[model samples]
Target: MPSLREDGAHLGSAQEPAARRGQLRLAALQEKVMLRFLIKKGTRMGLLILFAFMGFLHASIPDSGADDMEDISRFMENAGRIGRNIEIPENLHKAQGQKEAGKLLEYYQSEAFKRKYEAEIERLKGTVFKDTIDSYYGDSNGAEKDSVKGGTLPGNERIYLFISSSVPIGTLRNYARDLDRLGDPNVFMVLQGFVGGMKRVKPTMDFVRKIITEDADCDIQKNKCSAYKVKVKIDPLLFRKYGITRVPAAVYVPDVRIMDVTLSEGMEGNAKTGDHYVLHGDASLAYMLETLRRPSGRRSIDLLIEALKGGIYHEVNKR
Candidate 1:
């Protein structure tokens, strides 16, 4: 397995250049949008509009420096089918959902995703500062004492909420909380990349942190927010696996509870896995759940809904 390890300090240092490049890219995009608008209006000043755009584009998108995370692309595999259906390899499936989510989260958080940051995170766990930060930001959606109230993932259905930066912050926040409430590592909120680009991982990290912390407006570094309970992941592979072409969509994978694609050990030889049912829209989780349940008579769907209702959502779990 590729090591999901990296130096946390290097992650901090690369922010300057990446932000500069991001600003340039944003400016260029704005100029292009303005150019298209002005030309469509038929002001008979196409030449002048083009001239203005050229200046803005030159200033905005700039010829460019480079990104700190650019190195990751060299190591990163593009998202696409592996050209073969690989089945679950073994009991190694124990490393299933949570491992994938946590590893991807660390991949985005660490330097170049080559160095592991768990040691640092674990080291911080016992600090007074970390304690204060966790309490203020929220350590869980409704969990107490680092204890999640649930049994095994509880069903054969795997849920995924595919989203992007374009989705409204409030919508993302609600989804994060709901998934956290479900308390299954198998359930996830997957973003394709940061708003501007994936050349840097900080933006994705910061945005997801905000989404899970329930502090959309809080400037993460300057302000205190709720503890982040969920670990939003970026997995283009899963995105491709689900055939996601837009934001605010969801996928329901039924059956094969023990055989998620994220499992790495034994999927190399298998040919069949769960079927994928996708729902496209910007709706509440409950709405999506109901819509997905409709038209499908699979028992797994109901079992999935029951699992959602269990865990922290139980009568006492809710209280």
Candidate 2:
């Protein structure tokens, strides 16, 4: 009876504190939700920026010059490997029997390698020789023995042949076709092992000599093709300049130009301390063909410059 109203007022005041606590809890929960949302948005934004940068970087790369050089190098390496592995001659020894024979068969049957090899070799024999040989191979600027005749390249382009006398009949037949196709007057060939290997039959030598000397001009309609015997002695200076330390090396000289390394470039020479096996006619005629036909802007004298520089050095890639 003394405080019924007072009691009611105290109850109302108690309810106020409880209400305040509820409001505070609600505020904290809202803040947590907002923070989580912000973090998720930030993560998405960062990912978007990373992807944009990657896309921009992916759209820029060139197509010529250095890339072409790299392609050329790869091409040469592939050709050399293929030629070395296949095209077996009579002297090729497969003493390991079935194992070696199977390996040889695998290589021989690889159409991809064979096609590439054939194309490159044919190109060397055709284009490079056609472009340069007539100027230097003959006694007097590509003249025939009886007439003071000038020469022209077959196909009216560069024609060069990188061949070993020991090549198989199939390879020779393929080569013959290419020679037949040249229609220019100045085509020429560099006989890689012309002077030093085991001698061939007189008939074979006479036939090859005659083909290169007379038939090349008659069949191809040009006096440009010619052949020269690569000398036997491995000139140390020349070998050093070209970095050709391997034996049985051949260097095609169209206009006397070589395309390998040069002495001034600090290139090492082709000499082994105690072995003479590398000094004979076992020269890499195919590589020499590739070297002689190397692309150049200069004329005949450029060949001499290349030869002096040691054009045989880069014939094959490093083992």
Candidate 3:
């Protein structure tokens, strides 16, 4: 019923709403796709960051061998400074000996002594000896026995055998006998017992003296005529410094000038430098003798045994 121009105008107006609806739908679909893409990219970025953080953690761990070496070095340095100018306790120096050496031997071999020693060693396990050297010798000068010029014999270096009163008397006897047989007068047997435990001290010294004079006819009163060499000291401080966690340990310095030593992997070159070494546990005479014979290519406990066997004192005296 309308003219052609008017009909065309009405058709254009009717199509406008449909066109707007299509445009709105297309824009909504595009926004959803963009959001999905953004989410995926963010997730990938987060995963990459997590992996990088994990890698950083892995690289920061310490090497076990290096840590052990560091501990050894620290121990050696501390051991070098023990018992400088401290006076020996009177009770320790007093010789409590028996006229009958065989009688003393019987007492040590008795079951009573065996049980006592075993129990004591067990009790001492995991017990850390306090570092009391500073308190004990505070008034004296800061001089150390290891550092003293004439403290040790010239042309005769010394091997210090540390034994706790808790150690079996038989073990002490055997160790002393072996050292005596070695015919090295430079070896010193040290007793690590309570300073004022007179009841314990008396028997310990008696046993030590008996061992010294077992095969020989020596006057205990004069502290002479015995082949065995013994020194009584109550120094938990020294034991701690040397990392002596067990009884019947041995510590020796190949050269007096070397303040410290470490038994590290591939330390053959350093072994020749006259450094200090410690052998822990109750080492048999046979084991010790064999170790002293070969002092190369070993570390930690093995190296210590080897150094002793190699006659570290004798080697140092040669230089």
Candidate 4:
């Protein structure tokens, strides 16, 4: 043996290199196994997250059929409410008859209407004898003469009938008949149309003339019946002043103090300087007659007289 110590040292060095190689191989094998285990765990977590997302999406979705039906039901309920709100009255004619009656009662009860009537009466009473004709009729000598002759009576007043050309011919005829039956000569009729256009005037005047002069037996050429004289004029200003918004309305202006004296001692006069009892709509002849007869602090008189008026009736056919 060359040297026992030297031999041992050489063997130890050789064994140390082999041990190092074995340690490197074992470390690489452990790294691969750890990587595989980490990848498998990550994949399982990703799959669980994906399933949870799918469940959330499913829960958020509404049932399309059920939602649509609910929306339809809401719409139908709203429509039914609208239909009930706009329901029509069954008795239209009956409603029409009561329309003015309610209004008249309200007006009678209104303090404002009473104050207005009283104020107007005071103003008019101050100038009762001043010959204050309405400025609507021109202040010419001829107009003044006409006003004195036909426009007014000594203690009587006029009935201003505000009518539109659009009113039915039958309705006009009925009004004329109702007025004729009243037959108060002092109550002059003033037919006023709201329209200002010249084109509309002739037709309206023509209609009024026809209705006034119409008789069963007489032709237009030979018709000699003396009908109630109606002063037909178009005055929008007058209509606005009187607060006449509707057609077929009658404004009955009573003499100052006459209405108050007749109805009650303390009752205010209803007639203003330009104000009148406004009859809003068409009423039956009997209804009008009875209503006129009521002591509403206004002149209650028949407008039509038996004596035939000579001037306009003769000239209507000529026109």
Tens digits of per-residue lDDT, candidate 1, 1-319, equal: 1222132112223445888757755766677788788777766677678899999878887443457456555445442334344566767756787797788666665665423333333433454225644432234333221222242333344567889888998898888777666556556677665556645545555566657666556654565455545546556656766678998998876654333332321123321445667999989887787778876666655655676567435646557
The TM-score leader among the candidates is 1
Clashing pairs in 4: 182-302, 183-304, 184-302, 184-303
Candidate 3 per-residue lDDT, tens place, 1-319, comes to 3223422222233446897757755766677788899999999999999999998888787667888999999888777666564567767533554445556546544678556644543432213111221221121222233223332233224456778657776787777655544434335565544434533644554554555544545564543343343333444444654566777877655543323222211123422334556666777855653454356322333533443455546646789
TM-score of 1: 0.48
Clashes of 4: 4
Candidate 2's residue-wise lDDT over 83-186, tens digit each?
Answer: 88886566545556767767744653467644653454344445544643332222232132212122232112223333444555344443443333322222
lDDT winner, 2 or 3: 3
For model 1, the stretches where C-alpha displacement exceeds 4 angstroms are 1-156, 217-219, 222-224, 257-272, 298-300, 303-319
Best by lDDT: 1
> How much lDDT does candidate 3 score?
0.50
Q: Give the TM-score of candidate 4.
A: 0.39
Worst 10 residues of 1 by lDDT: 1-10
Give candidate 3 regions above 4 Å deviation. Answer: 1-157, 195-204, 215-237, 258-274, 292-319
What are the TM-scores, per candidate, against the unseen true structure?
A: 0.48, 0.22, 0.34, 0.39
Q: What is the C-alpha RMSD of each candidate to the true structure, in Å?
A: 38.1, 26.7, 26.8, 22.6
